[model samples]
Structure formats: C-alpha cells, structure tokens
Target: MATLVAIGYPDETTATAASLEARRLAKDLIIQPDAIATIIRDREGKFHVTTTHHPVGAGATWGMFWGFLFGLLFFVPFFGMAVGAGMGALMGKMTKGAINKEFQDQVRDLVKPGTSALFLVIERSTPDKAVEAMSQFGGTVLKSSLSKETEAELQEALHGEKSAAEV
Candidate 1:
C-alpha cells in the first residue's frame, strides 16, 4: 500500500535538509521510493511543500488502448492486430507502469505549503522501519492504503458525483 509521510518545517533550508535526511534513512532501511516531494519557498520565506511524481512508463494506458482494440478485433470480422495490441498492452501494464503511475498520483496530490510528503509503497509487514526512519524529519503522518482502496475511493467519488447530478 502507499503511505504518505508528511514533514513540515518553518524554513525551506531546514525542510530540505530534513527531507534529505528522511530520504537517506528511508534508503538505509530499504524503502522503495514510490514518489518524491519538493520544497517550495514562498515570498515570505516560509517553507512549503508540494510533491510531484516521477513519470513511469505509460504501459497501463497502452494496455487499456490495446484492450479496446482487441475487443474491437475479436468482435469485428477480421482484425488480428486488435488481439495482439490488447495482449501487449496488458503485458506492459503489468510490468510496473501501472503501479508507478498510481504511486506518482498519490504523491502529487498531497504536496502543499508547510508540508513535504513522501509517498512510499511498502508491504504490510515492512512498513515499520520505513515509518520510523521517515519520522526523524518531524512531519505529520498521512498514511493511505495503496491497494484497491484508492481506486475504490475514485469510483465512489465518481458515482457520488453522478448520483448527485441525478438528484
């Protein structure tokens, strides 16, 4: 699952240093960096944070496209390319692009003033060390499950909006 560890600081330099330290500790404890946060400096010199996710391969998108193509081919009279594209897209999605994209989105949404958040993808059993290591930077904890829950929330939100419109 994805856990967002947020660190807030009064100044940009201190926050940046703390973020680096947190990163180092996370690395030392073998945390897989799913995403990264950035330090923002406002005109008042107060440090703020916002995170953006590094890009991963666009395999999942490719897969979705291929799925549509293959479904079309299978249903259509004679389109062999559809099936091949769909299969290729599925393979690409499974090879890290999908997970990485998910990670990036999670990291990007939470960055704001006075907070630098690191999004870490961890196994259920291995989160303790990462949590401990990252805490040294002194930030609030904003942990969210990185599984179907996030996707479920998205679905729920969409459905809610649609339902509201219906009313």
Candidate 2:
C-alpha cells in the first residue's frame, strides 16, 4: 500500500522549501517517496507546477528520430532533420516534456488561489519523525491514506466535488 499525502501552504515559497526538504530527507532514507509534486496558484491567478521527475532532453531525442523518418519520406534528409529538431524542441517545451498532465490539472483545481500544495506519494515513512520534520511549515493537511483512491475520495469530499459513484 502507498500513502498520498497533501499539505497546503500559505505561499509557494514554503511549499517549495518543504518539497526540497522532503527530497533531502528521502535521500537520507528517512522517508521513501514514490513520487512528489507541487502546485502553486500564484497571486496572478495562474497555476505553476513543479515535479522532480521530468526528462531533461527528451524533446531533442524524439525530434531527431521523427525528423529522420520524415526526411526519408520526403527525400530531404537535412531539411527534415532541421524541421524535426525545431518542432521537437517546441513540443518538448510546450509539454514541459513530461509528468502526468491529468494529475497536474487535478491538483491545480484542488488548491485555492495564492496558495500552494505539496503532494507526496509515499511508499514508507516514519510518521512521527516525518511530521516533526515538516512541522515548521505549518500547512493544512488535506489528505493522507494508504490507498490512492481513498485519498482521491477525501479530496473530492473536501472540495465538495462529486464522488465517483455520483459521476
């Protein structure tokens, strides 16, 4: 079983710091995390998301491959390569290149404006110690459970959104 833990903070700075702290702790073997993501709704009403697991150069790689194929199709290898590389780079930037967009959107909708939330998918944790380490940030605990589905249900309940059954 895994636990989905979400913590709400007053601002992005705290949330970001808390996430960094969590990563540092994870490296120390204090907490084992399967995944972690942060969502911040800025003062401008725009949302920003950060995750640790995004490929740094996936765009170029995919672009190169596609470019080669297209070049072969059009009989213009160099031209195809250039176009593919450009298009691939653009696509990568547009996509932020990786991570689950659906999950990101779901989290974006869950938090209020001018606030940030830290979402951690934890495999194992020393509950008391982990809580103590994160206590200084002082966030509203949104959800915690050994089941992702149950956690999702709690989130829906908190937001007064429809449950899966009703949907």
Candidate 3:
C-alpha cells in the first residue's frame, strides 16, 4: 500500500528548512525519522524518496564477511589465525574494491546543482503538515494515491485472477 504524497517547496534548502518548520506544523513526518527513509538528491535537484526495507549492513553483505574474517583471525590460533588473517586481508581488499567502484560512480555525479530529492516516510495522518512544509519552499503539492477501487484491481491482478487490462 504505497501512497504518493506531493509536497512542494521552492528549493531544496527551503524544503530542508521546512523539516524544522514541520515540527511546529505537523511534527510527525520528520525527516530522518527512525533512519528508515533515504533522501536521494539527484543532479536535477529533485527529491527521490526510498524506504529502506532490506538495508544491507555497510554497503550490503560486505560487513558480515569482514566481521567473520576478523572473528576467525582473533578467536582462532596458528593455522586458523593465519587463515583468518589471509582471508581477512582478501575480504578487506574485496570490500575496499567494491566501495571504491561505488564511490567512483557517485563521484561521477559530483556536487549536483539545486535541491535533490528529500525523502520522508509520511504516515497517513500527517499529510497536511507535509503539504504545508513542502509548500513553504514555494513548491506544489500533488497527492498521489490509489483509490479503493484501484487497490482492489491491483490486488486482483496480484492474485492472478482478473484484470481490466482487456478493456
């Protein structure tokens, strides 16, 4: 059940500012609430909102691999320690390699101009405050949500039953 709510702000900074203002106005749709939402500001200065469902620990599963290698290296002795150290070094290099590649891609984007997408996990009740805050930045609010009928239709499709795609 995804609801698309639009909050308009004049610029990114203003939108960011409204996060503070929202406290006085709405107080519920606070940015960085629970560290659940990710704010992706693209080069065009548009805000993209993504709710992190399965956040892999530290650039994905690499965290666990590195952790295990260290555990083995520390807890084990002799050949085990040697093995741990070797594996640790290999895993560390591998982790660094992946991070570097990702950073390179990000670096290519560089410091983009204007405001990027400011993400927020808005509940059903705080729609008004979200709208108000976004508008403070001189932006427009466009609430996008699926109606009950639409939801039913989507559910039907999901169940592989019937759909309106025919007509």
Candidate 4:
C-alpha cells in the first residue's frame, strides 16, 4: 500500500529545500515515492503548489488527487458552507484509503498562511536513511497514512533514535 506523508515547514524556502532532498533520495533509490509536491501559502493566504515530474504515466491520477485535496482544504471555505458540504460529500465518494476527514483537517491546519508543506505519496522507503537525511530540515509530520507501528518508527527515526534495523 502507498503511504501518504505530509510534512510541514515554517516557510516555503524550507519546504522547497526539503522537497529537493526528497527528490535526491528518490533518485538514489533510498525512497520510492509515487508523487511528490510542495505547497506554499503566501502571506496573502494564496496557495502555490508545485509537483515533481517523477512517476511517469500516473500524472493525471496524482494531478486530480492534489487538485481535489487542495480545493477541499483551501478553496472550500471561501466558497461558503453549502459548496463546502457539497465538495465534502463529493470528496468522500471520490477518494479512498487514507484521504479521509482527519487527514484533510490535519493538512488544512498544516499549510497556514505564510507556511509550506511537502506532500509525498510513497510506495516504499528506507526509513532510517531517509529520515536521517531529512531530519536536518526540521519539519513536523502533519499527517501520514502509515500504520501506528510504522509511524512510531518514523518518529523515532526523526528523533535520532535507533533505526528500524536496530530496533
């Protein structure tokens, strides 16, 4: 199963740096992500999103996923309660596996004004190396579809604890 991981940074620069590191990791085969994106909310509260060109042939799938997610999280409120409800129902019917209400709420909170986030749909990864390499960027894990045990391992790795193999 693919893991959906969202990490929030204090600003767009940090998030962009982290995304580049993630891409490097993917290139080195330390992690395999189906899709990767960076979302930045400007001071004016507008969202700017950029996605990588990896995972060829699945562009349309990821594009729709990101569009719906961003629209639900950022655009719905401006559209008012009625449209929000309609979009909520549509989202529930259209999405599956991990993209539920809680995740959506967490994402909404993560990318506040002047903040940024890195979103990854990962197929697989070397948790230790990936975490170690990324810890320097100092991001908060906004949400993830990983299992409880796996999430714990990731947290430990982020905290510089023993790696998965060591544990």
Candidate 5:
C-alpha cells in the first residue's frame, strides 16, 4: 500500500526544490516514492500542480503511432494523426492520472495562500535516512498516512533534533 505525504513549504520555489531533493533521495534509496507532486497556491489563491511525468504527452504519442498505422489503410495519415492525438489528449485529461486531485485539493486547503506543498506517494523507505535528507529543507507536515509517533518523529527530524541531546 502506498502512503501519501504532503509537506508544506514557504513558497513554490522551495516546494519545487524540495520535491527535486526528495526525488534524489529516492534514487539514493533514502526514500522509496511511487509518485511525487508539487502543488503551488499562487498569490491569487489559485492552485496549480506540477508533476515530473507527462501523461498527456505520452498518450498523444501513443495515439499518434496507432493513428498513423490505421490511417495508412485509409490514405489519410495526417488527418488520422491529428484526430487521434486530440482524442488521446482529451482522454488523458479526463482520466485519473498519477496525481490524486482530491488529495491534492485537501492538502491545498491545509496550506496558506502563496505557499506550496510537496505531495508524495510513498511505497516504503528508510525513515531515518529519508527524514535526514529532508531535514535540510525543513517543511511542515501538512498531511501524511504515517502513524502519530512516526509523524512526530519526522517533525523533530525536520527541526534537526537528534535524540534528547538536541532538545
């Protein structure tokens, strides 16, 4: 089962930077993430989401390929490609992509306007190492599926607290 974690940051830039760091941490085996999304609440209170994956583009590309092959039979390759790409893009937009909009909106409400949040779908991870990696870019935990104790420990980790000595 994948756990969702949303960490709120001061700004869009910081959230984006932290998302990149989290990706790097995943690559380093510090954290295992199924998906990572960045949500930015603009100055006007509008929310926008940024993702590393491009599902629409992928869908269009595949549609174009299939369309071209089918069009060859009808001698209307360009027309088929155009129609297929459009349809595919529409489908991609309508379908549920990687990011969960409901969860995103919920997290968005948790963050203040002009702030940003990093939403992650985690499969599993080494908590200590992942927390350490995120400590440098301290953020407030907006929401997470982690247990209360683990979440509190993560908060402490973000504050750079190492055991009782730091406190």
Candidate 6:
C-alpha cells in the first residue's frame, strides 16, 4: 500500500522547507516514499510544480499521477461549472471509497493563490520520527491510503490501458 500525504503551507518558502525536510528524512530512512513533489500557486494564480527524482525508479509513474491529480484539484475549477461538475463526478467515481469527496474538498480548500503544498507518496515510514520532524513546519496535512489494487485502478482510470511503466 502507498499513502498520499499533502501538506498545505501559507507560502512557498515554508512549503519548500517542509519538502526539503521530507527529503532529508527519506534519505535517512526515517520514511520511504515512492515520490515527492511540491506545488506552488503564485500571487497571480499561476501554478509551479516541482517533482523530485525518486531513487527507487518510480518517478515517472508518480509524476504523472501527481500531474493528473493536481489538474483535477486546481485546474478543473477554471473550466466552468458544467465541466467541473463532470470532472468532479469522474473523480468521485475513480477514487470511490479511497480518496473520497471529503479528502478532495479538504485538499482544494487548503491550496489557494499565494500558497503552496508538499505532496508525498510514502511507502513506509517511522511515523513518529517523520511527523515530529515535519511538525515544526506547521502546515495543514491531509492524507489518504491506497491499496495496491486501488492504486492500479486509479492508474488505469487516469491513463486507460497504459501500465505505470509505460506512463
């Protein structure tokens, strides 16, 4: 199973600091993450995304997943209500019981213009150490777990028949 953890910070600096801390922890083996990324929404509402290169070689797969997820959470709203609603229904169905409406809503609410967010796909972790180290940054954290099967389903939903490697 993999856990998706998103932390929203008031500014890009804090979010970047938190992302660095997460990378440090991963390097120390305090947490094993499949991938990590940061999303910053500038004052003009433009989004800048940065993704790390995973040592485990899952970078491309998770990178694509993050892009699609961010597109739904941030970009869809700009397409007008009809399109947003249709996409919302699709997201709800695709996530189903895993990353449900509430989780999606919380994520949407957390990330606003002039703010930033750190996203991590954790495979294993020493929760206490990881949380303690990151808590000092003081961000709003939202998390959800995906079973292996559900992850495959999500990948399929996002990319049709393409496998993760092909992504």
Highest TM-score: give the candidate number.
6
lDDT of 3 at 137: 60
> Ten residues in a row with the worst lDDT in model 2?
67-76
**What TM-scores do the predictions have?**
0.41, 0.52, 0.33, 0.66, 0.51, 0.71
Name the better of 1 and 3 by lDDT.
1
- In candidate 1, what residue range of length 10 has the lowest lDDT sum? 156-165
How much lDDT does each candidate structure score? Answer: 0.40, 0.53, 0.37, 0.62, 0.52, 0.67
Candidate 6 lDDT over 27-142, as tens digits, reads 88766543677888888888888776432222224445566577667763322222233234445655456565687799889889899998876656643456668899988888
Candidate 4: give the clashing pairs: none
Sorting all predicted structures by TM-score, with the top scorer first, yields 6, 4, 2, 5, 1, 3
Q: RMSD, each candidate, Å?
A: 14.9, 14.7, 15.6, 10.0, 15.7, 6.7
Q: Between 3 and 4, whose lDDT is larger?
A: 4
Q: 2 or 5: which has the higher TM-score?
A: 2
Model 5 residue 125 distance off true place after TM-score fit, in angstroms: 1.1
Candidate 6 regions exceeding 4 Å error are 54-60, 76-97, 126-129, 152-167
What are the per-residue Cα lDDT tens digits for candidate 1 across 25-142? 5465455332444444454534343332332232222223323322331221222323334335433443333334443344334333444433344433356666676566665454
lDDT of each residue in 77-97, candidate 2, tens digit only: 433334334444433442351
TM-score of 2: 0.52
**Better candidate by lDDT, 3 or 5:** 5
For candidate 5, the TM-score is: 0.51
For TM-score, candidate 4 versus 6, the one ahead is: 6
Off by over 4 Å in 5: 32-34, 54-109, 146-167
Residue range 39-143, candidate 3, lDDT tens digits: 334456443443323323222222233233223322212222222333344444433442234332342243244443232334344556555555646644444
Q: Decide which is better by lDDT, 1 or 6.
A: 6
Please, what's the RMSD in Å of model 6?
6.7
User: Model 4, 1-167: lDDT tens per residue?
Assistant: 34677888888688899988988888887665436778899988888887753322212234445566666667723222122332344345434533556887888888888899887766466444566677889988754455444433332322334334445
Report the number of backbone clashes for model 1.
4
